[model samples]
Target: MHRLRCFALCATLLCPSPLLAATVFRCEDPGGHITFTLQGCSEAQDLQLHRAHNPTPGSGQPVPLAQTGKTTRTRSQAKPSAPLVVGEQGDGCGNRVTGSARRTAMIRQQVLAGMTRSDVESALGKPDKISTQNGRTRYHYRDREGSSRQISFDDAGCVKGKP
Candidate 1:
């Protein structure tokens, strides 16, 4: 057992660890959301591969990967087939709301004050007509019954006071 242990130790000290190279994938969805992962992305997303190799031996430092060139593989070079749907409340909106609250508000189609332009656009789709007068912007929408609903935004791009 002692001789075997010595032999194993000698072998380990003599052998240099093999260099390993890992392939990393950077995926971007149609909405331009980026994510990096070892696993590849779906067919709908744009795929980019980044390869990094292990550092050389005896240097006591890891070598940085060279930025040779970038490779981007996309499913389709043309525009996406479907439109992107932005969430109602997230993405650093001033109106901070929980998931449930945002979902309920979206379902109810409620556009509250303090909500940004993007927030309103997310909750209710694009307006039928937009008009700007005296630094205030108004978004007009016509319902199925031909009833028109209007939302006004102040110069700051936030809904005024209350709905």
Candidate 2:
């Protein structure tokens, strides 16, 4: 009788009003990348063990993964492109002619006030070199003809002086 009473008490303590457990899904891509999703677990090939819990109904909150902080590593197997080449003659507008005339033209057309360092570098390849002094950063770009242009930026990274 004592054992029966203890079992009944334990059953009552363990069983609660009906509450459904959350669904979990694991997925693998063609590239061998594995992703776990809670909303789409039926597609998982290897079903893991299940536990009983009262997950809030329709909360739509994502279950945080234990390995969420893992970073992916990638390898590149292609060679880098050669430096851009320019032509010898000058355009009628006084701009030196170059095979990269379109790119140079676009860079010259951009208004410097709102430009960022990355934008300048994208328009013009990495500067021949960079120098900083007195809160100013200077980017120098040298052409094949030995002519060089210096673009200066203020602390805020906006062009501050004439290029």
Candidate 3:
């Protein structure tokens, strides 16, 4: 029995046990580098581990998922989301949110055709680079991790990108 326990301990130390594993998003880049993280990745081949969890602590039962969307957001567990608003510097529009929170709220929105310049700015923060030529302009937005968006505008200061 003691030898069996020792062997089991050695085996565990060599190979990770799935029972203790947490769900993660795995991404394989084109350069053949693989990365694991808890956040979503947009520019790579991705694999997500679906984990079953107990709703209540000490309960062995797994929570049942609602079958309605790509991913379910349960109202019983969902927190209130902040609304996106834009105003002058002193109008209390950007005061309550952190820089990351601002980015989160903005990035979730799509830049639609015919959106005003100010509306685009409200949906997405300032552009990293701006270039204009022949009455068409492009605003480049780049996150620190190299994810980017290029928003083009027509001569009328309205978005030319798809909704």
Evaluated at residue 159, the lDDT of candidate 1 is 74
What is the per-residue lDDT of model 2 for residues 48-110, given as tens digits with 9 covering 90 to 100?
434445657577776554755776655674445885567645433233233455455456744
Give TM per candidate: 0.40, 0.33, 0.33
Would you list the C-alpha lDDT of every candidate in the order shown? 0.81, 0.64, 0.69
Give the count of colliding residue pairs in each prediction. 0, 2, 0
Per-residue error at 119 for model 3, in Å? 0.5
Which pairs clash in the backbone of model 2? 25-41, 87-98
lDDT of 3 by residue, 1-163 (tens): 9999999999989996445435677777777777777775666565655553335555566555765658678988687598657755531232344456545656886565556567668897788899989978899999889998888877767667455
Better of 1 and 3 by TM-score: 1
Winner of 1 and 2 under TM-score: 1
Tell me model 1's lDDT, rounded to 2 decimals. Answer: 0.81
Deviation in Å, model 1, residue 103 alpha carbon: 3.9
Q: How far off is residue 103 in model 3, in Å?
A: 15
Q: Which numbered prediction scores highest in lDDT against the true structure?
A: 1
Instruction: Indicate the TM-score of model 2.
Output: 0.33
Report the lDDT tens digits of candidate 1 across residue range 90-146: 444465555677677778889876667877888899999999999899999999998
